[model samples]
Target: MGFDQYHEPPNELPDEVRTFARMILSLIEEAQAIDWYEQRMAVEKDKEAKAIMRNAQKEEFKHFGMDLEFLLRRKPQWREILQGILFQDGDIVEHGEEAEEAVD
Candidate 1:
């Protein structure tokens, strides 16, 4: 191996960037959950099942891109809160409860 091909270290992300990343990751998880729900609901043979899934999918897509836009816009605090909710280390229920409390 030659020293001519040294690998560069990844850049250190600011707190805002980290938060945005986490938020996007969470949105992805939510989308996956919606997909799972849609699949489960499909087994019921209900006519509205497909419509529900389609709407959920559309909302997921919107949120996914919205999170990206927030990151791009450097809305750090909002991103931080969103990330806190998304990557709650398996404490989604608690995070949601806290979010609700915070809103009040």
Candidate 2:
């Protein structure tokens, strides 16, 4: 019954680190749920079922966002890097490169 999220011994890790690991795991789960719903909706023949899947997928998206935001709020540098890349209209790769450079 050991948790796979912690790379190190859980007892040795601080509470904040443990919480961070939990949030990271939660984020991963939410992303997986979103992907699962996407695949399900793609293959689903019933329109109503597809619509319900879409709705559920949207909820997963929200949860993913919340989890990401929680982690980012704790990591200022990460948030700074993301700020330069997210919601920008320019080239994504270029933005990422610039963001990395700016942070360095």
Best by lDDT: 2
Best by TM-score: 2
Q: In candidate 2, what are the lDDT values of residues 1-104, reduced to their tens digit? A: 46989889999999999999999999999999999999999899999999999999999999999999999999999999999999999799999999999999
> On a 0 to 100 scale, what is the lDDT of residue 21 in model 1?
60
TM-score per model over all chains? 0.39, 0.96
Worst 10 residues of 2 by lDDT: 1-10
Query: Per-residue lDDT tens digits of candidate 1, residues 2-47?
Result: 2222233214556555565667676667678767766766675766
- TM-score, candidate 2, is 0.96
